[model samples]
Target: MRKSYLKLFGLACMLTIVSCSLDDDRVNFQYTPLQITGASLPDTFELGRVYTVDVNILRPDDCTLLDQFDVRRSFTDTTQIRTISAVGIVLDKDECAALNDSLQDAFQFEVLYTKPYIFRFYTSDDSEGEPEFLEIEVPVKE
Candidate 1:
């Protein structure tokens, strides 16, 4: 029994040492909220149809890449308002290049409801550190 216990202890120590031998300089990344500068949407949408909107995003640095679009809809109201924002992946690195131009991406969504959709894109923060949005209402044609 004593010999078995000694073998288990030695095995645990070896496993710990092997795990600690992993590279410490592994690539690190974080999800960051990106600013939506502008969006090119259609004048109107037809029901039961799919549409694509080109969204312009303000890239803070070259290390930032488009990750996903955060689209939230208000179920409490029947207005069909959707609050959308762009999220980016920022690589945690010591050196990052600055971006001079904005990046554009396409966002595709299907129109299910006949009511108009009020799309509010998150633009930037105001003077009081409040979030400002670019609101656009698009009517639907049945």
Candidate 2:
């Protein structure tokens, strides 16, 4: 009877392993290759005014944060631009998570001058894939 009980236990363990692996085909969602589904900015912005802007980041699953940002300036027109480094802007991770899309993302920026600038933000997962980013134009006036 002892030998029979041991055999039953081993069979049960094997069945459990097989059953779990059988669901491997379920979705197989990956977090890489993130996309920015939305970008929001005010139609009119004034110099030295703090403003809240948002970008909707999307992933196949809900498992990442909006990581970093870059600022640039358009020289003659929107076509030609250069990256401008400055501070006073931050990523609101908590707010991003509460917004639309699988992953939430938005940035709060304080305008330093009355000039047009380009803002870029990046997002990624912990495991893999190249960084994905989005850029928005901030047109400021005096």
Top lDDT prediction, candidate number? 1
TM-score of every model versus the real structure:
0.83, 0.42
lDDT of candidate 1 at residue 81, scale 0 to 100: 90
The sequence of per-residue lDDT tens digits that candidate 2 reaches over residues 23-51 is: 45443322233455556778767888888
Q: Stretches of candidate 2 above 4 Å error? A: 1-33, 62-101, 121-135
Q: Best TM-score goes to which candidate?
A: 1
When summed lDDT is taken over every stretch of 10 residues in candidate 1, the lowest stretch is 73-82
Q: Model 1: per-residue lDDT, tens digit, 38-127?
A: 999899999999999899999988889989999998743556999998999999889999984599998898999988999999988899
| Residue range with the least summed lDDT across 10 consecutive positions in model 2 | 84-93
TM-score of 1: 0.83
Task: State the lDDT at 52 in candidate 1.
Answer: 97
TM-score of 2: 0.42
lDDT of 1: 0.90
